[model samples]
Target: MTDVQELSDWAPDWLQAITPQNRAGLQVPDQVEDSRLQTPLSQLSQSNHDRDDELKPPKITNITVMPSPNRMVKRKLQGIHLFMITVNGTLGIGLYWRGGQILELAGPLAALLAFLLVGLLSWAVMQCITEMLCIWPIPGALSVYVSEFVDVELGIAVGIAYWFSYSVGFGALIATLAAEFDFWTGTSGDKGIDGGIVYLLIPVILIAVNALDIEIYGLLEVVTGCLKVACLLAIGGVLIAVNVGAGKQGYIGTQYWASPKVYDRDAANDWGTAFLMCLSVAIYAYMGVEIVAASALESAPSARWTRKTSDERESQLAQTPNDSLIGNTVRFSAKYISLLATISYSLSGLLVSFDIPWYHCHLPRLSWVDSTANIDCSDVSDSIPANTTSAIVAIAVESGIPHLADVVNVFLVFTCLSCASTNLYVASRVLFGLTSRLDGGKGQPWHLRLLSWFGRTNRYRVPLRAMIFSAASFIWVPFLQLQGGTSSSTSIGMFIEILAQMSSVAVVIVWTCQVLAFIRYYHCIKRHKNVLEQQKIPQLSRDNVEDYSYRSHAQPVLAYVALAGCLFVLVVANGAYLWKGFHKFPFLSSYLFIVVFVAMWILLKVARGARWRHVDLSNPDKVVRKLRKLHDIRLAAS
Candidate 1:
């Protein structure tokens, strides 16, 4: 503080002595390169500096108070709960109607094969997501993963594709409920419930259920999940019992193949039409398999309080209020459970298919009080139009135990309601995630708006704006069926099935991304290992990095296999539609899946002002940041 303080005190004179008076007097350090040092700040002019300063964030005013702690919003969910909610969502649409259609398209043998193969692929997608959840438990689950692993543009593309595909569920369910309401009330012909009570009720009911605290929703899901599991089991058990009791007469394996003449072996029943119908059926059967990802948001909130002991990071992940242990367990359990639901639904379809003469004139709707109960299904001669799954229950009830059929119908209605609830939740959350301005602390623009509308201290946080958006988004589906004429009996059903199948295809793509992420993670670990080995350092204490590394490496292979399987299903299921007499069929809906996917991606890219140059990974500026992060060994992106 002696000499230095004296110099500092007399800085007015000392600065003049040390400072350069002009360009000629300036003396820069030798270490500074000409490219950098030659660029004098004063010489550059004020406009350049002004521009640079403008690019930076504005400083916060001293008068502004720090933001309040994110209002202690709901925390992250556990792995299990996340898993279960996902399973319930995924299995919802697929089990209800797709199986019977698959049986008709691929034959019993082929349909079963399709289910197993697709299920494997679906599982792969689920596992990849599982690994992702472990690594990054955020609300924008897939979108976040894709952004980090692939380029941000690609991530945004995938997110948009996924969101659009998911929106179909909300739309499809409204249509489905309308169809059900029409059937029960006998107004499906024309001026039916399509534009009536069901459409309005769907949104209102969905909002009511979703607006509750997440824990209440979880409890409801658990109860519904259990019932869904029981329903599938009961359906399977009853079918098996009946088939066994029917003995040889109950089994008609190649009936469709043998009776081509009766069902029409003509131009109308050619491979193309048959294939289109088959694909239409198959698509509908497996539509809702991606619902798992949708459930991730709510699951975290439900298991918010549960605690677990693990890696500090993992424990941190677990205790994140929304990312609790219970949620994780539910998510994982749901994946396997979805497979069970698929198999049960498939078996029930198989049992019913034996009774229907696929190649002949429509099979009798079971004999008892019967002849008048006969549905004039001439318009829908290709497939069972009015509630296909319910049709099977009708046949069984008409033929065997009528009482049990009545009981099953209640459960069937329960399944539809559960599905609608799940879809609404998904729709709202998707809207929330997509519209949310995440750069604004933990809260979004919509979140604050919700807080204002719902009250600040409310435990139940509902994005009312998003819910309204979802409600509006689905309004057209029910009414759209009115334009189809008499053929419209199956038109709404067909539209729903078509869209649902496309969503499944989109899920396959998302699943593929998960696998790719797994592969990248594996390579990252491998690179890290090789670097450690080359250094040849002394023995050091280690974390379970290797275990995680091993898991990351192993899981992707399964994911790849699943990806291949999904592609094969899309090909086989839709192959007949595309390859055989392409124009003769309703290829628009089938093609619409890919069309929407690409169009949405392009629109998102355009909206973001992203171009090929922006996505270019070769740009040095873009890569240098990553290289610096790797070499400098800084904290990871939280």
Candidate 2:
């Protein structure tokens, strides 16, 4: 058996107090005597109460405390809501389109390899986030962590970069959403959709979602997330199955790579450009993992339910008093295993790249002049497969399953729209954080503004002004569309990809911090005896290595691999691209955007009356204490 199993087996019935039943009652301790406190911070209190102590009621005082109406309603979001928010944030436009671009560079084999490699790296980053979340479990996980573990400048830099990336990415998603719908419905006519109507809709819905209580939005995300994931899984499965059933060399199994030009390095005289293009695609796939970190805020407040269930199981095992200790150990081990199982479901999704799909093909060799003669070949022009990936998938579906186009189209549109909605919401939040009100005091220049709009509270505590600003940001897309040139669109995509990729670079930095934090947390866990004076540390009496903190084996291995992998991609692939100036126009522009915004964030820090004295490291407990008080005040008002 494993240590986790053993711990689950031995866990005592008394541990039920840690479950979600009383999560609202949770309070943070005033201080930590030593650094290694193992218990859930929520259960800790400044004054230790005996196990059998009776609950005490609060005393009324003579203070004139006028009750305030509930300023905001707290709608309990279902688990599905959490799921949609996560899925929508993570699975977006790239899944449907970018696969073809990657396929063009590396062939099918290389494309699959890219997905696999990025997926594993993403999981490592997520685990780091998981550890931090377990420790602090606050809203705005990245911003909070950056401010806490790293320098304020690093945090501000990352935050601004991230917000910009999300905003631009949101615009891209809206465009893609319009494209998907256009492909399905054959309705490209303008109410404003293809840069006109569709772009306008993005921020309106975003504002509406934000204006409502967050839980409502969360619920919608979970529902849509389920639909999106289910649709994609069905598509991937049916596509592969249909290919197999058709008895056509449907699986292909790297046939795309049989052509030497597909993988041959010498074929690419423009190696710098080729590699930059590949990095650009890979970064698109990697962008969503940060969404996972963004979601820590929405997890259930306490593990008390887990504790309660564990204790009940332990009590049953203890019925045979003669076997009390032995049976209890077994039960405790089981509890931990079950908790791990719950976490494992999310991990599976994190690991497997159930990403968007695209089309791939090869055309007969032709010169530029020959291509001009064969104008129809424009769809698949650039020396790679060029059919409309979306249309191809839809056609394949319609052909394979008779009259299935309607079903496929609906699924496709839903997936696109849900993802678009999610992108818009996240962008709004990012914009709220970035656009400061301090510099713009009541109406400053556009360049000087930062989050001033978001500071304006609404009935539900939503940032109405910020939402408007975010909506305004999307208007840039129509201007791009009004130009109406393929070259211009391509340039726009590349520019968005560059900024998004740089933000991804910032994500890597954030992930590195999280990995370090998780490693530190594991060390803290290893010192469990010192952390938990109330309970004896369980003995590891098993040889099975899988039962311990998988973090012990898996996390260390992944950390080194990911660090080395990121370094190579950034310094070698991306660095070479920058050095060679192949895509320097957009490349330099992206860096400039990042640098200017980072400077803005730093300047705002000075302008906002921020001081080093406010930079206190009171530990996670202190932060939780403040949050608990806030929660209490909210409850009292309600």
Candidate 3:
């Protein structure tokens, strides 16, 4: 008899019933099964019977008893770690440099408005993510949700694009670090140590940190995240002090905003166009905020629930309060971090606008511009060394606080390092998620079979291969400095801008997919409400149906709003090329990801002959039934 037939003969009914075709009914979608699917009871029974003849347990038997390879990412992150990472992931070098870029692109008020608008979109995206996370709480939750609820092709596309975005962002961080180091050491092109050397070292350090236990990474993020918050606060205080005549230029209140030249008339003719153009920059600033959801795979509760036997999991659930679940923590963290990010970004824009004239930073300065009331355009020189100093540092210098500029530069280095590490961590996990599957299973498409190599983990339970690959991919970004040119600073600035724009586009696309996925999930839940109610799932029970604990407020309305916002930003922010007459480089950088995304979707569709699985109303209860089983198990265990 075939092995499958033989196994089925002695397998328990539960084991016999489990198959890929019907896994959706069991509430275990193929993607979730990729991580937590246990070995069939029959396999264990057969292994034990066969091993009885051996004097000791065979090595293979021990391997069989271990958790699946995909579940190996250690869950060491606690509630505090999640909260801090959520905050820190989005808080990075962008905050340091992006303010000046946006203020230069759009005037102060337009920049402030853009930050607020994107913040609302971020809120909606996080709400959708948190709600879905409460239900699945799986590793690589973002792409997995897209794949499960939406379609596999789109999920693959989003996963790859998101991973690419982080990878590219990591490169951008490295470039920023080199720029900061140049500023700190008073070095530039054809000068002191090569920036490329610094680039090489940063990634090595980040890889080492990520390679350690996840808890250590979490702790590091918490510390750096706190430092980042403190840095922002200090900068804010300094800005306020400078605005009130503490600096060389006294009583600088609203001087810049009141100037007719405050807005960049060259960039955009109208305030509205300027606002639209800067949306991508604002979105880039908020890119990493949703990483908390990505890190949910390693969360303590999620880990505990996934690793336990059904009975053990049930017992634990019986004792644990529902509110204490990872879902609640994720929801709280999302809300807290989004609010914090918005306020911080808006205030930074507003404060910077007060101290420095938008016209002052209109042209990128290679070296610090000194504060002088009578400074003329003729005094501007192109010979200053290129530095990665923020507009805030320029403000400090212009305020006669040169020492404060140095301190801010130091903090900027740390911020870049912290953010680079987070990017690597997220990218590796996303790549790992993309390649995860059952051992020896043919579930993944042939094109992706080679990537399965990165799916494995070492004894530390980290996806070491994937981590190494991700770090290595961005190593070339810093080498751009090696290219000899008179306008090296301008080159670096343009490179960073291109990366930011492309990454921002990728972020919006991912957000759009996520919001759409949530919409589908929302509808699926509604269609299956009766099944869910009958199953007595607390979150969806008859009494609690309308007031689901983890449900995001405003339901479908907020989701649609988020969707519309993402689409608007994706099209409008990148469409500047269309109006300005397409420059080859800008046009490519702006919409290249979209072209890549569409191409990928088509390739996968053609390769796999897959079709978009429209809302499967017929099996609407599949997800609901799965939730019911999970709830029932938890109750029984309790």
lDDT of each: 0.48, 0.44, 0.67
What are the per-residue Cα lDDT tens digits for candidate 2 across 1-638?
10110111211221222332323432322122211123335464435654223143322211111221121223243344544565676665555445545544434444455555555666655655544443343334465556544445555666655655666666656555554555433433344455545667555665576567776677667667767768777765655555455435344323334542343132233534544445545556456555544443333322112235777856644532121122122222212322222232222222121221122232111010112322243333242223234432533443446645456656766766676566556655554434321344345656554444453446665556655665566546644533442121356544544444555555555555455444443443344423333332222111222222122226556656666665555455555444433455545533555456557766867866566433333454544333333222222222
Q: Can you give the lDDT of residue 111 in candidate 3?
A: 53
Residue 573 local lDDT, model 3: 70
Q: What does candidate 1's lDDT look like per residue over 1-638, in tens digits?
A: 00111111201111222212222332222112211112233332356556474344433211111112221224334554444455456566456445544543444553454455455555566666655454343344566566655656666666656665666667776666554454344434435445555666656777787777776777777778777778767776766665555456555434543533221122124544443444334444454555555544444433222344556657665534222232343345434644654565556656655544342223321111122322344534332234334444544543465366556556666677777777676766665544342333244465445533321113454555565666566556666666652122254445655665566566656666656655554444444543333222111102354223113224446766765655554555555454434541246555666666668667767866876432333433333233222221100111
Structural similarity to truth (TM-score) of each candidate: 0.68, 0.64, 0.80
Better of 1 and 3 by lDDT: 3
Q: Model 1 compared with the native: what TM-score?
A: 0.68
lDDT score for residue 73 of model 3: 72
Cα lDDT over the full model 3: 0.67
C-alpha displacement of 511 in model 1, angstroms?
A: 2.8
For residue 443, model 1's alpha carbon misses the true position, in angstroms, by 18
Ranking by TM-score: 3, 1, 2
The candidate with the higher lDDT, 2 or 3, is 3
- Residue-wise C-alpha lDDT for candidate 3, range 291-311, written one tens digit per residue: 877777677653224577889
Clashes of each: 39, 39, 3
